[model samples]
Every structure is written in C-alpha cells, then in structure tokens.
Target chain A: MTATQLSPGRVRKTPAGAAAPGRRRAFDRYLNPVLGAVGVAVVLASWQICASTGVVDPKFSSSPSGAFGALVDSFKSGDVWSPLGSTLSIVAWGMVISIVAAIPLGLLIGRNRVLYALTDPLISIMYSVPYVVFLPMLIFWFGIGADARVVIVVWSALFPLLINVIAGARNLEQSHLQVSRVFCASRLMTLRSVAFPATLPYILAGVRQAVGRALIGAIVAELFMGSAGLGYVVQLKTSNFQTDDAMAAIAVIAVIAVLLNHGVAYLEQRLTFWSRTD
Target chain B: MNDPRRKLVVDDLRIGHWSRRSGTFALACDGLTFDVAENAFVAIVGPSGCGKTTFLTALAGLIPVESGRLELNGEQISGPSRDRSLVFQQASLFPWRNVVANIEFGLKAQGRLDAEGRARVAELVELVGLSGKEDKYPRELSGGMSQRVNLARALATDPDLLLLDEPFSALDAQTRELMQEELTRVWQADSAGSGKTAVFVTHDVPEAVFLADRVIVLSSGPAHLVEVVEVNLPRPRGPEVKRSPEFQEISDYILSLVMSQNKPGRRTEDHDSNAALSR
Candidate 1:
C-alpha cells in the first residue's frame, strides 16, 4: 500500500499552479520576522510609556531602556559569556547522556514484551512526577553544584527521548520484521539495519522535546542552587531589585531555547527527509 | 552435497492450533500429501479460510506440524531459513531503507558478499526495472515499485524455494496483471542458470492457471488437497496465453471445485451418490 493508504483520513491536495517568483519570495520574507518585530515593538513601547508616566514603578517593572542598559553592561563586563557557556555546556552534557541511555533502552523495551511490562508502570510514575520535586533530593545527593544541575536536566529530558524512541521501535511494521526473519539477519544486523533506521524519526522527535525540557531543568536548577549561570544571575538580580538585569537574563534564555529547539528540528528534518515525503 | 534435483515432499501432514477452551487440536489435516518437483511452479488456489496459508506456513516451518512429516531436499523441514523465502501479500519493504539497500539486505544477512554486493544490487535493481530509484526509499515508491523491490530482495539471495502468498492481491487489476507478467518473465530469465522451485498462493483461479505447472485446489477450513490439475502451457507465457482455451478449461474446472466446496451439504450429496452407485 502507498503512504496515503497507510495513513488514512488526511486529504492531500496538490497546488493548482505555480505563482510568480517575486510574489512567492515576498510572501516568504514577510511571514515571521515582520510579525515578531511588531510584537516586540508594541511590548517595549508600552513598557517605556508606562514606566516614564509613573503608571508602573520603574523599580519593580523596569523600562525597555533599563533592560537594554543592563544587557549592554552584562556584555561589556564579560560575565555574560561564562554563564551562557555554563548553561549550554550543561544542556549539551544532559542531551548526550539522554541519547546514550534512552535509544538502546527504548529499543530493548520495545522489542521485548516482558521487559516493557516490567518497566511500563515505573516509567509512567516517574514521568508523571514533576522534575522540580526532585531538585531538593538531587541537591542533597549531589550537593549544590553542576552535578545537581546536570542530574535535574537529565531527569527532565530523559522521558520524552525514551518515550518517543520506544514508540518508534514499537510501531515498526510486522511485514518488515518478517522480511528480516526471512533473510536470517543476525540480531545485530536487524537492530542496526532495520530497527535503528526505522526508529530514527521518533528518536529525533524525542530529542526535540528533550531540548526544551533540558533547558527548563537547567535554568530552574541553577536558579534554586547555582552560583554562576544565567539562571543564577537572574535570581541574584531579582533579589537585589535589579528587575532590568533579570529581564535581560530571561530574554537571553528565551533566545537560547528557541535556537536549541530549531537546531534539533533542523537535524530531525535532514535525517528523516524520507518521512516527510511519504 | 550440492544436489540441484532435490524436491519438497509432504506425507500425511497434519497441522492444527490448540483449541482455546479444550486445549486440543482445533483443525486437523489428515492424509494430505504432495510432492513439488525441483524447478516446478506449484500454485495453491482455494476459498478464504481454507487453511491454505496455514499449509504454506507449515511447509515453510513457520508453524509446527501436529503429526506426520514434511521434507525439503529429502531432509526434515525445520524453522524458517534462508533457503526458502516468502513474499507477503503486502510488499513489506523496510520503509526506512532505499530500494538498493533493501535488496542488499539478504546478502548482507548471509555475510555473502563484499564490495561486489553493490554491483549485484545494481544488477537486481536494473533487472526489476527500477534502475533510477536506487536511492529512493520504500515510502517514496509506488505500490508496484515497492512490490518490485520486495521481489528483488527475495531473489537477491538466490533462494532455492520461493513462496509467494497472494503477493499481487493488493494491486489494481491492471497492475496485478502487469506484475504477473513481470514475475513470469523474471522467473523464466532467472531459471535459465540456476533452477528454482516456487509455490504461489492465490484466491484467483486464472492466476493459478497462468502461473503454476500444477494447481492444488484446497478444501475449506482444516484444508486438505481436493484436486491437483496440471497445466501444459508453454514457458515465457504472455498475456495472450491467458485467453487460450486450455487455460479457460483448467480455470473453469478449478472454479467448479472451489464453488462446490463453498456450498454446504454438496460434498455429502456427491459422496453419498458415489457410494450408492458403487453399492
């Protein structure tokens, strides 16, 4: 059966004709950035106006100019680089650990029913519990340092990666499995040739989800216990009534999160190009 | 050790599953015996729920035989092996692997080839008329193309016995016909050097007649061999052969046998009449 038959319910339509090149290009150009700029401009203008008119206290809710000044000061002082580097490093390490652990475990659980049954309830319970609840326990175990932060990041990110990978492996077509059997493929050959490639898309989707969760876990853990990181800076500024500095730090975190999410998405698309066409 | 004349023989083969409540034999086949000669194409045609697939699976060693014995190359049949390959009704090509990679899978499995495997894969891809689609994954292929890849994958290993289970049933009428012709051509061409045996299963009588040297008509559930009709049609068969009188005659005979089996009480009436006449 064709992909259309395999996946029923969606009605696919082809474009009737091609539009003029210039018009299409223009449509693409205006799609996102224009809307984003407009959104940013409105928020910044409203904040500036409210703070200047004393409608909102400048000390509590910093003006756009105050936030920009904080942003500039952080850059000039060179302190921004170290914290940003630390946050990225934690996220990277957490992701690496997640990938190494989750993919093989997912495949193992997916292929064997008994293993799946044994782990199913445990994974469900663990996944359901919020990661924040583990932060105190993690700190007690690893102490208030990078180790504790990394543990929290791993906890938050591991589930999505594990679940998606298992889903991918579980849903592989029985026909393909039969084909593998007919060939008398070795266990390793089947895993590498049939199972791995088939499960890659779902694994990538899991990674995409993990990226977002990892960032959240890292930032939150840092806020609670870190001495030097973007989250730590934000927390320190908030305590000292430096609202502008905290806002600047928050903005940097948002940009980093967007970038990381998009990066994973791009890699997913490149790897599973066949999935989209199908 | 290299015997090219080996034949598959089944003697008094009985196959059944455990009954849900009683845990006893649910459906049994008794005194069901047949011999498929080397290089022969045998087709099993019967109504749905006839246990034709069950019999094929038994022969392929996919299911355990409850009683009697089955032999491949004069040795007792065992579990699934590379010597016998199955083509399912659906072309179960690995969606993740491209056409060439899919075809090379079997070769890779057997540890049979090296850099030369690529050349062999290319040749098979060309033989299947999928020359330009080496890099195209199964998802991107049409139903016919995917089935072609499935056929190619099976053939790549040069299996001694090829079992096809309604392989063309999912295609459109025209595509099915084309695929049949393509399969015939491939079989004829491939058999030139190394002879291979094929057992095809189908519900279509004409397809059975067109493809098989012998058509085995099976009785409904707990299936047994009802009749075995031989086709004397010449090799390198074309679409024109399907219109021949001999082809129609065999097809009609098989159709009647199938129809009679479907009607309740017909077998009893015929048996009773024959018995009475003998008395």
Candidate 2:
C-alpha cells in the first residue's frame, strides 16, 4: 500500500532496487569510446614510428599511414565495392538460409525424443569438425563460385545456432510449461508465445556466434578459391606485393568485423534486454 | 459428489503414473473424494511428501486423473481447459515480458485478448496492487510482487476455477504474510460479487486456515482424504486475523495433523519437499 501511493504530479518509474542509470550511462558512453580511441591510437602511433624510422621494411609491412592512404585511394577508384559487396552478399544469403532452416529443425529435434536421439551424434560431429576441412569437398561439389562460398558460410554458421536453439527449446522451465498447459494454449500458441520468447536469449546468443562465424567462412572461402571478395582482394594484393593495398583491404575487413559484432551486440541489447540484469 | 450445486467434484479419484526411469508404479492419490461449492475458497494441506500438489495439478488438468470422477461443472476433466487457470508456485513470468504482457498471456494464448480482455487485464493489474508497475519485468519485482503478477495472470482469464500451488511458500516470512493478506484482498476485488471457485494447495496450516472456507487435509505419501475442516472466519480478513484465537486453534489442529504424518522428527522437510511440490 505504501509502495503504490503516489503524490499528485509525481511518478515512480525506476525498477525496484535498481539505481538510477542516467548519470552512469552517460559516463560509460563517453568513457568507452575515449578508451577505445586511446588504445587504437597507441597501436597506430607505434606502427607509424616503426615505419618512418625504417625499423622494418615498409615493403613487407605497410605503415598505418600507408594503409590509410591506400584505403582512401581504393574507395575513390571504386574497386573496393565489388569485393566488399560480393563477400557481404554471400554472408547475408548464408545467414538467411541458415536461420530459415535451423530454427524449426532445432525446435523439432529438441522437442521430439526420437529425433533428438537420432540427430545428436550427427550434429555433434558436424559441429565439432572444422568447416575448413570441407573446403575441398565443397569446391568439388559446388565449384569455386558465390554459391560455394554461401554454402561454406552456412556450413560454418548453422550448427552453433542450431545447438543453442535446441538447448533453449529443451530447457523450458517446468513452471512455465505448466502455466502454458493450464491455460490450454494450443501447441502453436505455446511455441509462439511461451517457447519463442523464453528461447530469445539463447537465440540471440546463437546469432552473435553465427554471424561472426559466417563472416569468417565467407573470407576463408574467397581466399582459398580465386574469387570476387575482400578475401580475394587481400590475396591478389599480397601476391602482387602491393602490401599497402593489402593492408588497406585488411583494414576494411577489420572495420567490417567490428561493425558486424557491434550490430549483433546492439540487437542482443534490444531483444534480450531482460536477460543479464536479472 | 453428486450435488447439483457443486462447482467441482473429485470422487474416489486415484492418480498414479508408471515411471519408466524407476520401472515402477507411483501412486500419488488414492481413492480421494471431495466436493467444492460454487465460488467457495478451498485449501488443501498435508505433510511433506503428501499428494496435495498432485491433486491440485490434477484439478488444473496438468496431470491426468487415473480413475473415478474429477469433474468441473459436471464435465469430466481430461486435459487442460480454458475454463481453469493455475497460479504456479514460482512466479514463472516470462522474463522477457513486462508485467502487463505476462498478465495478458492467458487471454492471448486463448485468442481472447480483445478490447474487453485487455480492460479486464488492466483491472486485475490494479486489483493485484501492481498499478504503476505494469511495465516492470519479473526480475525487477520482489518475490511478493512477482507472485502478485502470477495471481493476476491467472485471474486475468476470468477462469471458472482458479488453482494455486503454494504460491507464497518461496517468500520470506514477512513477505509471505503480506502476500497472504494481498491475495485475499485481490481475490475479493476481482471476484467483486459472486466469487470464482478456488483450490489452494499448501503445506502451511496457517495459510490454509487464513485463506480457505474449507481446508481439506490429506495423509502422507500415497495421500487420500483425511478430514475437511470448515473455517467460519469472517470475510475481508487481514494479517491480524492470523493472531486471533480461532485462527490459531484451526492452524494448530491442522499443523498437528500434518506433523503426525511425518515419519521422522523434522525429517528434512525442506529437501524432500520439492518432490511433493512438483507432484
């Protein structure tokens, strides 16, 4: 009764027992970016000094300035788009296919005893073995093309995601399950309402892992096969001894990796916001 | 059992299951029979491994009735139905959902969260004293608060029969007492005029006496009906009612009944209680 009462023109908005986050959030927001910039600046400064002082051959290891210059030049020349687009497209397609295929399959395998038993060994083996070992067979089957690259990405990304979803579906709380049943929710309703929301934290985690692996798979595929991607760009530049261009492409790939991770992390924050704080 | 006005009838009910893991037959309830009048608040109490929770689950249709009649409104209870709802022991709110969304789950599950249903949910939220906290998540709420949401969620559907499974047992002593008072208030507020029939299963004798018009006591494991004590306590009761002589007398009688069923003196009730809770 005391907790419920509010004076006129007043409100109680903060969650019980949680401190106000406004001041702390602002400090963290600025502090992290400042700290990250300092770390990156230190590394770049060290690299700049070594290159300028001729401590190592710039021919073999490009300086931060050289890479930065090449990056601008490549963007101006417009050749960066082709490889970046190709690699990104492959990752995008692979993720779409994997998500479409994995969620339902994992749920079915998890919910059904016979299916889980039948697939457990096969899935474990598939997840355990590196997809790098499958490159030769994949090329043999699908050839060194965009389709092959997408297939490899799916191969690498699907299992971690599938496994997480299976766990989420299988580890349902007995009380939650009972609540759903007592409400007489149909099977579909149970899945959509109870199971899906409950599984969200695990699913988001799986997506974070899957997206990281998918990017890695796409790059590796392009590197091994003489393909049209940032990986191939890095390969071609290195073979030509254009170390600056290769470093620039590497820099672009690094930015892409960081951006992809942040994108998924932001999604996790939005979707599974209730997970860790509790 | 054959009363026309009886809202619920559990006649010679036997609930048993074949456990594949143990390769044995586990009998929970044995030839139990009882009747609940329409809109009456009935509570069940027993010793630690007694089948009271199993009986409540059977009434909720989460567990199957092995034999005899377990009927609501004269229809045989088979599986879960929309006419009934259960307030689980744990709060069991989806951590992802805010309090309002969790309360709306029952209506939403049954495809009845229309404008009217939404209004009813809002009403229950207020009734349960969660007015300003509708958007709060389960983790943010205290034990007592979460159970309020649980109770509100069950009531949101306007179930004909509400089954509660030791909803306040997990709370601390003070919070549990406060919640008991809150529950009675919410029950009356939501029911408004003619109340809904409710069956509360608990190990706490005081809680059984405080909440129910009738308290049905069961024996130990393989539990059956032992006695049904009618509590003629005045309605609109408060926490102070627990200190009254009449309340203490009823609670003490039920407590002794429960204690007599225990095999050993203070035999690890906390540890083995989980079995009875989930039965």
Each prediction's TM-score against the native? 0.90, 0.91
lDDT of 2 by residue, A109-212 (tens): 87888999999999989999998999999999999988899999999999988988888788777677778888878899888887777777667678778999
Give the chain B TM-score for each candidate.
Answer: 0.88, 0.93
Off by over 4 Å in 2: A1-35, B1-5, B18-22, B191-193, B263-279
Candidate 1: where is the Cα deviation over 4 Å?
A: A1-29, B1-6, B18-25, B28-30, B191-195, B265-279
Which tens-of-lDDT digit does each residue in A1-278 have in candidate 1?
A: 22221212222233334465877766766777999999989989998999999999999998889988988888999868999999999999999999999999999998888998998888887778897988888888999888778888999999978887777778776667667777888888888888888788788878888899999999998899999789998999999999999988988998998899778777876777666643
- The per-residue C-alpha lDDT of model 1 at residue A50 equals 98
User: In model 2 chain A, which range of ten residues has the least summed lDDT?
Assistant: A1-10
User: What does candidate 1 score on TM?
Assistant: 0.90
Query: Who wins the lDDT comparison?
Result: 2
Looking at model 2, give its docking quality level: medium
Q: What DockQ results for candidate 2?
A: 0.66
